[model samples]
Target: MHRVLDILATEDGDVSEVVNRFRDIENTALRTAFHNCAVLLRMLEAQAGLTPTWEGGPGAETQQAVASNTKSTDSSPPTKNAPKRRFTPQELQPFVDETQRGKVSVAKVYVDGASRGNPGPAGIGVALFTMDGKKIAQISRAIGTTTNNAAEYTALIEALKLAKDLGIQQLYVLSDSQLMVNQMTGRYKVKHPQIAEFVAQAQELAKQFAKVSFHFIERENNRLADALSTAPIAKIPNQRTDSSSQELMALLDDNPDEGRTE
Candidate 1:
């Protein structure tokens, strides 16, 4: 600690000098200690909401020019890294149109899971509808800390359970998450052990229904479910699950996915 402080105080916070000093240290234990100290300092800086500055070397000018060019292009198409635009809940609806030949008695279920920080406070949302497009039930619940994938699986599981309780025999499951949909349909393998457990649970619940089909939809087609899954109630400390669920259910029921296909 003292050595790092000394280096900062004497070297005017020159990270390069500290880097050089650590590079010169031959003792493995001392080097490890320095590494830990550096990591701690970085974590502290992050906690303080500090914008880290880097001393960009020779390519700094080139990088800046590229950035300026990207910013200057007014009519250019979006880059691969552009932020995705979300659809309003009103815009989401079943992919199948009313004009479709036959409307089976299967219940349509749209499920979504949201995580603020991927592994942060998470929530699951499920919207159910009868074959003729009558909204029947909705379920949303905050599941505390979990990954998006976990929340996605949880949403499906809860939806399956709800369908079972409703005595639903046929279910058409829909999700915006291609990964979750693919995994459920056996198109993709569940590589993670935790995800495998969730999949197994969902499978067991699915057995209650005579037939359950998984389908992948685009984000725009899943607005209602997405909105419920990412609702603000999930972030409240000591939040009431029932209240959150009710709020989400209301939102889902009122904001029926409608309009023309994108």
Candidate 2:
């Protein structure tokens, strides 16, 4: 099931190819695993308001059942909604002040992560700069879905990898996700099973740096990374290409110091 989820998360390769690749396994176990994963994927798709059509095949009936379950789950939500709470400006002032204090920095490296349909298409974005406000590097790549935090850590890991590749010894990493920053800095506990491995990978990479520090930043300040993270995937041939081109140009322009030779 995990293998199927991994493949589905990538959203690459032909579905038939995937099924064929798993054909070596015993039929009963394979069908069980595939159906289980398909069920979960159908649920995720439903949450994203996508209706999947399964053409008649070995697992077609099971897929239909999963889709039906998804529809029922969607229709059953919230007979009566829970009340919402609002925070007053005065009450939020202290936290705002703390955030402002946290933003005090000459240079900031902003990183962000994005996932399409939550556990579906995922990507990571990173932007780095100097203390004097010189733009350094901006990078974004599609990484397939797992989770938001996984993508976040992957972004940070990629940033660190790039920094090391560029011979950067000292850096101040900044991200909008406090959980990620705090966990990396050993200030917070990493209890989530999904993120533990990624956190360990980040920690392992950190050891190679001469000096590395992490700080949390407001989402507004981290807009470049956020934009890159949320940028839509380009569809080839039939669709318009200009939008993705512009986004790529903007990302490139945001950081001029990329690949600079010391």
Query: Largest lDDT belongs to which candidate?
Result: 1
The lDDT of each candidate is 0.62, 0.56
TM-score of each: 0.51, 0.48
Give per-residue CA lDDT, model 1, range 1-262, as digits (tens). 3354452433222243454466668988898988999789767645433312221111222333354455443432222223444645453332323332233335677899886655557888887765434556777668887667778889999888777776676777888777777777776666567778998999988888767888776565566688778764444665334455545543332222211122
In model 1, residue pairs whose N, Cα or C atoms come closer than 3 Å (at least 3 residues apart or on different chains), thus clashing, are: 92-257
Which candidate number maximizes TM-score? 1
